[model samples]
Target: MSQPDTLGYLVPQFPGQTHIFFWREIAALEAMGVTPVLFSTRRPPAGLIAHDWSEAAMARTTYLGEVSLRRAARVLPRLPWGALLREAGRDGIAVLKDVLVCAAAGEALRDHCARQGISHVHVHSCGRAALIAAFARHLGGPGYSLTLHGPLSDYGPGQRYKWRHARFATVITRKLIAEMQAELPKDLPPMILRPMGVDTDYLRRDTPYRPVQPGEALRVFACGRLNVVKGHQDLIEAVRQLRAAGHDVTLEIAGQDDDGGGGFRLVLEQLIKQHRLQDHVRLLGAIDAASVKARLLEAHVFALASWHEPLGVAYMEAIACGVPTIGTAAGGVPELIDDGVEGLLVPPKAPEALAAALLRIAEDPALAQRLSTTGRARIERDYSARLGAEVIVSEMRKALG
Candidate 1:
């Protein structure tokens, strides 16, 4: 009498919230009565490795190794060398590295899949995660699926064999789907627009957000890895301008400080001091999910001035919690926030624009309240995790049956 084996490929180690996604997805599928054996990688910690999810998701999960050398070789030749690097002298070498890497890792992943008799493999990102799934599926004949997000790759339409290994692909926004399709055939595998849904039970809109206490500096919260695409610099400059113009703003950043323990992090610290923002800016490195929920409750506004995003569940979660939002006009963000409705959208990399939007929200109580009320409604209606689960489950049934 042993625990039943019902799992598929899963990478519990991917960075940020994405690392937690497959586990959550498994839970959703289990709630629908389909158990999958987890093929786990190094992404998740040991304690989280063999988990019995809150909704009994483990009934459908069986952890698996994250490496396979042989399977990787099959997907290596398909790397869609970006049009920009099509002819680079080092491009071939780069492709060779990718081939070796995937062949090696994919071979291991495939072995685990075979041992479990798993019928399908689904990956959370189009980067190496999807590539590994693609390679494993190619070697073992599992119907495979991959989800795309920003930074997966700057792929052009039909550029290489990006999704060639997948039976179907899922992306979070129409905008991203369109960009990905640029490199795909006129008709790509049932590209589905599925927003990353939050655990509806954990995140809610019933929290109360109130007026800042007199002279209590406004707390502006931004989350995500401190990288160029996140536009952290733009936010810092905007906050500086706001303070210079006599606005009282307190900014708190939460994410990993990959700054040599100081890289972009040091630059951010230097900028804060240069702007004399020692009193206004604070850095909280990589807060957990519970802490993030608390911050969302206390936050005056959520700002993600990123230049690239596939679809930010962070923003959706904020609105779901009844907080208004402001983000840069880039990637799939527009597809999420209906400008002047759910949230305000500004030009990417424009500090002045961001500052103006922030100050406007700070000053307009009615507008903020209005957005908070209606924005949550939008999430409940259009972006619920229930919707994602249903769409993905339907697709999985079609593929598996």
Candidate 2:
């Protein structure tokens, strides 16, 4: 069959590990004869884009933020003056800066896509990039759509505005869809349920699951940005308490501090010292994908006590590697992990509950084995990247018709 028409992707950053799901989805779509052209708002740091898999992608991505606006007069006639003024009135002075900047960049992006014959645009988040797509569409550009993910607090002034104008919107989980419906009851846009996916083949572990023995130390691994929302502090406290209770457990956390400065790292260090858990908890800084897989292979249990998350991919990765996963009953996580079937679910910020779940896995070998087997099977059956890309393509086809 001939290749499908190319689709433009408006994203905050291109080729960053944080958005690995997008990369996997694009790869799957390419295999099915769909081309994805990336348009990023900002170029990420060199260190973040250093992965071998992202080298070619970085070269192809266009960073609109870095483009100088010398031809502003040339694209002035394409501006949607009525839509711009109405949006300005709705948000007051608060959105004026974003509106002006993103609108200009949107025009440039629109012209670029027009030259490349791209007729449809998809934005990954409801941030400035989504606003840019909406602005472009209002200026007689291509029809656009949005793929929504969230912490629920990041939806600002133009969120509802973008949703209302897009061709259709997609959310990664049902929980997020419900939240969006409740927020925008009046002009709620059409929504589709499309969950992110993982590559089961790349994440599959060859070594079989080994249960913890009486005298061996139980290895626990967790990975994500070490920010307050991730609830790494709560995980540390749980491990400290577990060690105090005479359980042979060691927790290894792999992530970089993301609190602007080094303040968050200091707080975690203080907690470790106060509990005298110097030997029990190891702070392994941010690691690559290979390192993450290696750590998961050695771990008996994987846990991330996030107080708020929009369907964490780390949990899915661990589960695919045959490790018994533990996650809080936060946003969209319960959808990926059934309470006791795929993995254990605990309440956020509750060290006692987290400790209880860890102990349950440590004490029951059969339970751990069952979770591992079922979790991997779930990924193979429903969470492949191709499945998600196929659903998105189906929606795109309908929108075109």
The candidate scoring highest on TM-score is 2
The list of candidate 2 runs beyond 4 A from truth reads: 1-3, 46-50, 69-78, 81-92, 259-263
- At residue 356, candidate 2 shows an lDDT of 95
lDDT of 2 by residue, 1-401 (tens): 12245888777877665667778788888898888888898876654453456767777888877755665555556666676567678766656667666767788777878778787888888888888888777766787888888844585665657778888877889988888888777656688888788878898988799978889999999988768888989988888888888888999988766432265767778888888888888777656678888999999999999998889889988999999999999988999999888999999999999999999999999999999999999988878888877876777778886
Candidate 2 C-alpha RMSD relative to the actual structure: 2.5
lDDT of 1 by residue, 154-187 (tens): 5312224436656677778777776666745553
> What's the count of clashing pairs in each model shown?
37, 0
In model 1, the runs with Cα more than 4 Å from the true position are 1-7, 15-23, 44-93, 151-159, 258-260
How does each model score on lDDT? Answer: 0.67, 0.81
Q: Candidate 2's C-alpha lDDT?
A: 0.81
